[model samples]
Target: MRVVQGTRPLVIFDCDGVLVDSEPLSVQVLVDALNRRGVEIDEEEAYARFLGRSLSTLAQILHDDFDHSIDAAFLEDLRHELYDRFRQELKPVPGIAGVLETLDSTICVASSSQPERIRLSLSLTGLLERFEPFIFSASMVENGKPAPDLFLHAARAMKTDPADCIVIEDSPAGIEAAQRAGMAVFAFTGGSHAGAPGYSERIAGLAPDVVFDAMPDLIHLVRQHMEGPDRHRSPRAS
Candidate 1:
């Protein structure tokens, strides 16, 4: 059922590393695809460069950095391979279901991935029903993350002011996007790939409203942020 908006804050979640443990699989597939094309990239490099970014951004990276061209056939093949892995191995982040159940906020997913990929990840992990009709994708906007267009679009679609929304994200780009959208962001680092060297520090450097590594702690953190004396202040407010 769609959440009926109330006085509760809207929580916007990122799909990949925030909701589903698909980053490792996605990075591995992307690296393999690039290797097959003789681009020679690694999973770590891919994670740093492309995590929380749209497919167009990834294609641009390939074009500019590796001098490789991305055509429809290449994208189709890559999508097919990634989807195959997701079906076989994707899992929800630990305790996320409980977090979702425990929260009373109006929640939705706003992600850098395509709409189909987001739905598949949620369905495979049995989380699709929780976010149907509320999923906003970068493909739906003119610009993706790190530009705030997707997050802002999501806020508008949900009929919530950006100041009244909170974004749960697992990437630097995502946190930056939420901040750019003028929404408070909580950095979630519990995903499997979050422990990469300097990754947490990088996320911290972005100065999200909260940084937490356990799903169970989310409700408390969000409540504190939403109910605390500072709740009315924008995350980027001076």
Candidate 2:
């Protein structure tokens, strides 16, 4: 077990694809809901567009792409239905438990998901208690992913500087947001979105500090970063 010799670094994680295995279920629910309204969208396209985005953003995309009106009330209902149908199926990605346990850093979750959804997903995945009160929702900020607001908010909440925190994300929007926040980012490519053709290159182009296709590899990278001679220095943007 590699150890990070740093003075307790901070790590912020994105929830959906990074913590809980919810992206596929989320995409499926959106597809089913839209299909019911007579809108036909490819699941792959929906996943690409909706992953790491806020519900309001998704609603707008739905309306713009299909010329359909789905009000907040209907959207809430759809989410409730989806949660009820798939909540039991939610689970953490492989090696998450070990990685979290081995971390020498303070950890928190910062996600585009609503607080309630974040609670529900983490709870269902048996990881809710691990974060306790450190979980943050994008609703807490004025803007969601692709905007630096949420990550900045998380850094402030953690009482850490953006340069001292590491962000773990699985979506392009998330990677962009972390970069914009002036934080080093690691793209996790171990979920439903991993290796989705050009995923690696797309994330690389965003200039994440690092990218990992597996959880153990990510943990090892974090350990290495923490143990490196320049552990206290802020990571340079690529």
Candidate 3:
């Protein structure tokens, strides 16, 4: 059943840039790995092509699209390297804990990253306790973001109707996926990549329900969405 407007909706957060400040580090590993193998792509290209996308698709691009036959072993190596870097460098997004502490809705993580990767980062950032066991990964389904599969899979797993789930994401692909799944999506534009020169324009083109740059503002925006013009029910205060 759709979560009625007045009721608190299920809140699904994307892990990389939303919950943890790990995108730059994640893409850094990819860029360095590819360059070491003489692929020659820079961080900008990596972020443009792979940020918010799936690792499996990235492997396909390396093999089929770029003619760089990356073996599964290489992918495993990268995964291990990423985990190490995440443990050392990952930080929770600023003020995210406050929002998590106060939100009244059921919360879970639905991400494009591997389940292991998701857990590692969240654990490092001290945010895993809130989302443990309910984590959903794109690999669980056939497709990831921009296909609606992952979000819909998460919705089913969380036992929440698509319409009643509000996805907080940080990528264009994530926003597109939530829309395709018929959920309201709000984009987090406060990450390191969000400061890129053309990011604002790109996000505007996607046209999410709302764009927020600070983690503290998330609570207010979510409350406004839950308590619309008719004022069904105010979001619970912490």
Best model per TM-score: 1
TM-score per prediction, in order, is: 0.94, 0.89, 0.92
Q: Write the per-residue lDDT of candidate 1 for residues 145-220, one digit (tens) a residue.
A: 8888998899999988888888999999899989988888899999999977778888989988889889889888
C-alpha RMSD (angstroms) for model 1: 3.5
Candidate 3 local lDDT, 17-127, one digit each (tens):
999988888888889989988898888777777778887778777777678978878788898898888778789999999999998889999999889888888888889
Q: Which sequence of candidate numbers ranks them by TM-score, best first?
A: 1, 3, 2
| lDDT for 206 (candidate 3) | 84
Q: Ranking under lDDT, best-scoring first? A: 1, 3, 2
Error of 3 at 126 (Å): 0.8
Q: In model 2, what is the error at residue 143, expressed in angstroms?
A: 0.9
Q: Give the alpha carbon lDDT tens digit for every residue of 1-238 in model 2.
A: 1224756668999998898878888888888888887888867778677778987677778778878888778778787887886556778888888888887689999999889899988888778888989999888988788888898898898998887788999999898888888787898888965645566667778777787878877667877777666533332343
**Model 1 poorest 10 in a row by lDDT:** 229-238
lDDT of each: 0.87, 0.81, 0.84
Counted clashes in each candidate structure:
0, 0, 0
Error of 3 at 1 (Å): 12
**In model 2, where is the ten-residue run with the lowest total lDDT?**
229-238
